[model samples]
Target chain A: MKRIAGKKLVFFLLFSLLAAFPQIVFAFPDEGRFVFDEAGLLTEAEKEQLEYMAQELGAERETEFLILTANDTEELDLSEYIGKFYDAQYGTVATNPAGTNAAILALDMENREVEVAVFYKAEEYLNAARRGYIIEQITPYLSEGDFYGAFSIYLQSVYEFMGTEPGESPETDPLLPDPVMIGQEEPSESIFFQWWFHVIVSLIVAGVAVALMAHHSGGRVTVHSATYLNQSTSRILNRSDNFIRKTVTKRKKPQNNSGGGGFGGGSIIGSGGGITKGGHSFSSTRGKF
Target chain B: MVIHYKCQNCGDDMVFDSNTGMLSCHSCGRRDRIEDLPEEFITARFTEDEAKEYHCQNCGAVLITEKSTAATTCSFCGAGVVLADRLSGDLAPKKVIPFTISKDEAVKAFQKWCRNGLLTPKGFMTGDRIKSITGMYVPFWLYDLNSRVQARAVCTKVRTYERGDYIYTETHYYDVFRDINLDYVKVPVDASKKMNDELMDKLEPFPYDRLKEFKTPYLAGFLAEKYDYTDDELTERAKGKIANYIESYLSSTFAGYHSVSYQQKSIHTNKTNSQYVLLPVWMLNYDYQGKQYLFAMNGQTGKIVGKPPLSSKKIAAWFAGIASGTFFILTVISQLAGGGF
Candidate 1:
């Protein structure tokens, strides 16, 4: 009886270990990672820095941020792929996990496209318009093949927006206005549109025109020096040129170090919000590279 | 001292005709070539005191004249008179350019020129408001000048190239010297004190090919003036005119240099010859807005020189239009270039 009990215990231990393997892989904090670069678009150093930033911000905001890249989605659409990934990690709508907030940024290399997927409480902050604005800001960096820049902007924008209330401008403090709003309003009152600018310019033009007209009213002198010159008798007698000294100067040339080569001919996709097959509601903006 | 030409066919006084270039009769349409006339008729010989008052030959009226007036007409009789005493001896002119443009042609040309003034005041172009237009013979001195120029300048030549990671600039300095001789002929200087020098200078380049030997008949009908300043007194002015030409010519010889700065330069000029001559001009007096404006036209070439009053309202409108156009263009350009980048 003792020998039979030992064998059964060993079998039980093996079965439990086998069952726990997937749980470890799918767990969020267990992996302690936010970026998965399947496309190999970012350098190792860039990936490290982004990981550090996402970990710090995610902890502070009490949310999970995930950035994913793929060589291609094959026949599946980018949104469908994102939904499947989200379901595999957090379960489907029928078995949806409670008290979880996750914002996912996914890029598909083959289509040169990017999309965002939000889960749980994140949906309340990043609405369609706000998500579109974030994507618009990062599209230029993505199209330039600056994946590192795009990821950093994504993390920062998400953090700032989540801290503010819904239906509000994305400002760090809700009481103060957005800095970008001030910038846009300043130009309308610029000197180019002012009354004094037009008046001063017109006065200058009028003064010059009148002066020129008055000057030319008196006719020009038609007779030049050659008009009365005795050309035959005029001659050059002597000429000499002696070189005195020589000097030389040298200067170092300037160098240019631009970021990276761009993925040319990139374009934007349609933007909208919809519930995934897993019943996770999200607002997504599409950008191309 | 006043002499008048009498028409052989009719006893009426004859006047010099600009169109026919001959002595013409008004009552009878008879014209005589002064060149074919007797020497006595062409040259008037008279002895009179310079200070004495002169009377018109046709009318016994005392001619109101200035001291420098050589030829004028009788205001009462409207007869053409020539003062022979003032035109002879030391006050004589060597050459004369007779009036090729008549009084009617000059008036018409003046009106056309006025219409071409873009900034002139309203209705000023009609030219019907001219008070008087006088055909006058103005005295001038034509000078021949020769200049000797010697110059020394420091010049440089620069070359730039890229080698490896550095840009190299090489400059070579040169010491240049030049000797030149420049001669200008028939540079005219107006000797009349009454005429504006600036206006007269603008009406230059009279056709010297039409110059003829001076005869009293050329001044029979037109008013003439003797020289207020002699050629010897105006030599300095002629020299000043040719100084700019000499400097420009000196610089032309020192070409092919990046930059040139003159260290030392000398120019010595000498007057070779000067002759007294009479050139034709049409003077116009116009009255506008209680003000008198004077205009002068070259009788031989019909070149006009004068300033016309400008309209303030038109200038304001033009300024507004240009400013608006420029502003519109700049705004569109900035917007199209993504807010000027």
Candidate 2:
């Protein structure tokens, strides 16, 4: 009974705990930003550079670009440029040193053929100029476009600008591996185990309930039936007529002796004929049966 | 003639209470049990044949009297019965729903509703300006119907390809078919002519299963009016609702089809049943600047719906307060982060 009660109490507590503490599954954290531009214009070389950058950074390719143009133009049509790039065999192009009239194209590497932006400004276009330089310096030797050269150069410059070593990676960052993230993973494992654990606990609880009910009935039957049998035997013994007759005969002589002396004087004739008179009262006949 | 016990104070007819199990006088607040009387009286359902039309002796207003009817005062003049209506007919309803919420609870609910109103006029919540509120059982028709719909539409799928150094477009066509079965579409139609149909429609859908049978005893603490609209009139409104559902369902079911042109659609309905149900609503009518505003409360759900007065000054002040708080918090955070505050 105690074990059963304990099991039931445990079951209720488990249910309450489950209801109170809901398990939350954390989603994968977002990796990095996808840079985007308003206008779409990309040469084949620019697209390759973006794909390589995405791979190096461990980020997904995003269909967005930043457009840098020479003029402050809100609207520019780049359909002809896009069509030409599609037909061209060479991936990269280098313009003459008069880079003021140059257009720096960025492609949406994820979608393959969508031109994201065209950057044309020269004076204030350090990133575009660097990218254009990297493409021009490597594409001719590589036969198509040198993605590794552009990616490595960009990463090296960003590391230098941030005052960090170029060899640093996220895997070795001490502060980035936060303790809270580690703590959260254990609870996720426990949640996965909870389904089977609860089933086993429920079976234990059911077994306990059955054991408790059986124990209660066992005590009741033994105690009640013993008392009932004792009462019935006592009633039958007292009702026997032979035991009553014996007990009555044992008391009869004593009762008669106590009454004898009071009437002895008047019954003096009782020795012979058992005739007795009290205060001269008339005595009549004798009868024998 | 049966002797009728009537109230001496207000002279209104006393009603029998089954909860307290006594005949209660509404006017003078007197109560007595019928079991205390010498003879047992069985209150019969008032029929048109057994009803007597009594002309009001005091005000000449016609009144109906039955076995349970007890009248001491006239309805119009508020005077004791001098005469009774001679041609009065049976006006008592077959069933009624008793008031579930008390007057105090209703007022508290109303006040809570007022506090929640984002835009309410100044002094609107003051005790002096708070108008007398009334609990009314409004009549409505609940309809259940089985609807079947058939629709046909022309659908298109787009395909693009290159032909001789130029992109060309190709379109494909296919016929669309939709068959649907709908059941127990509950549509509520307001029975009162004074109530706005549009407002009632917006406050849709009280759960009809919770409705209790009508008992006149429930009317003791409330003001109620019988429905004036018939079933036939409400059926017309139900048809309009069904038509609207058909149009929307057809459009959404085939939403994937590009450039869908509907050819033909038909909706058929059968096994329609309607019941006249009364629902409890707490009404607050206020007149502000010559315009009246109506507020309603769902008695069962306790959800209040209404339009409250807006104050431009309050709104501006609130917006400014939020902006100041936001700026202060951001400034503190930035300073802590070694950024220019």
Candidate 3:
């Protein structure tokens, strides 16, 4: 009878853990190094350049920097896949005078998704507005099959966007090999402001509709009341409005990049750096390149 | 300095007839060609101080006019008199768009405009109580400007993605610029303070190609006024309008930005060329309930635009009609849903 009772108790405890596991989140410290190219898209020299730049930027800004590219996610449930492995292998403190907040940029080649994970604490440097700008800088190159150029631009822009003094390398740990961390079902990612993004999109769409309606109102509405405009001939003298800058943004693309890769019903989330899958909400802007 | 045309065949006064668009003699029934008039109309010149009044030789009636009044009819004999001085010197208009449509046609056009759409009052101007219809050569200042516009804006583009347990937002910034060169010609601003700015604006798109050189015969049948406002006063209006046009031209060029806001705007006018001219307008005024309702027609294009007073009764009827229609539809729909169909 006692043996049977023990078996029942074990089953009950296991059941309880399974039920509560999805809701539980774990916070981990930051790692000294940031740039990781798991997809092997970057060369040894290029990888070293990105890592060096990220490390210098991280040390100066006191905010963690990560640039990771991975192949297809292992057959793990997408919601459970996160920066958990990276989180557990990194820093000791959440916020120090020096800095340690999680900000990860993950490029998934198989799925054609470029995920940027920003932690709550590091949101100041990687705010909503700044993130949108960075995507614009990276997408054109991404669509044009220039992954290296795109990644390089992204890394440099991020470094500058954080308001860091370039070439001013603060005291950081020496270079180390990439850590091998097989992630478990641990949560360490957070997201905020999905509704706010939607609201902004709605307002923009409505404004565009109203502007179109106004444009078609009348011919008289567009020009001033000088009768000569109808009779005047316009000449373009030395006409040039060349592109000063070329940037592209992504906003929930049906397909990723100009490659026209068909998207499926699968998702893989990143976790870590004081964030988890359950209560730590996350928001991202995506679109076709 | 007032000039009048006389019938060469009958030796009677020849007046401009609106229906025939020619000088017609009422006594001898002689029709003369206006283009056949001599070239003295071009060489002739007069100043505001050179002419004050004149007497009709045939009718023996005195005609009085202001310095700017170039054309009028004798109140006693009803003879068309042209103040040649008003059409000359500094007061002379370099260009003139004569009244092509007659008074009868103008009144008919006004009535047709009142019947434009459902929003207009049903019987607003159909009662033939059009108190007065005046053909006026509204003084205008035409401007020719060559401008350069440069705009600077802070634009943002946002991209987003999701990985594992987190969604990421990626933002980028751009320093956007637009350099535009705009050459505006024949932008007209009314130089007569007596004309309603709004009314004149609605009478836009005057046919400028038909503009004829200043001629004395053109004024014989029409009432004309010299400019009261100087170029300096109207320049402010013209510049304001140019600035608005260039700004709109710049903003329309940008596309595909999540958010774009202008940080700096600069407009430079290389040179402004101006001319004192006159535009033709058929001005119609009606008095309803002691309130004057004015209607202006573009004498060139005949496109009419104006704001007419709304009738409260009409509005109430519209609301009632819509409400009842909606209520009936809902009632039928609900009954069908309840299996009463």
lDDT for position A206 in model 3: 46
Q: Report how far off residue B33 is in candidate 3 (Å).
A: 3.8
DockQ of each candidate's interface versus the true one? 0.32, 0.00, 0.04
Q: Write the per-residue lDDT of candidate 2 for residues B1-341, one digit (tens) a residue.
A: 12234555666665544345455776677886544543222233334345366665445577453322332344575443311111122232332333445556766876765555444545554432345566666667767666667766767766666645455556667677677655544466777676667556545545555555443333433445556667677787866655655456556666765667768876776636776666666676766666666766655545555565555554455445554554455445433432210
Least well predicted 10-residue stretch by lDDT in candidate 2 chain B: B82-91
Rank order (by TM-score, best first): 1, 3, 2
Angstrom error at residue A218, model 1: 2.4
**How do the residues A112-135 of candidate 2 rate in per-residue lDDT, one tens digit apiece?**
221212222311222322222223
Q: Candidate 2 has what TM-score? A: 0.41
lDDT per residue as tens, model 3, B267-292: 88643778888788877777766678
Question: Which stretches of candidate 3 lie above 4 Å from their native place?
Answer: A1-289, B17-21, B26-29, B120-125, B160-168, B305-307, B320-341
Q: Relative to the true interface, what fraction of contacts does candidate 2 keep?
A: 0.00
Query: Judged by DockQ, which candidate is best?
Result: 1
DockQ-sorted candidate list, best first: 1, 3, 2
Residue pairs whose backbone atoms clash in candidate 1 = none
- Candidate 3 lDDT at A53 equals 52
* Candidate 3 CAPRI-style tier: incorrect
Between prediction 1 and prediction 2, the one with superior TM-score is: 1
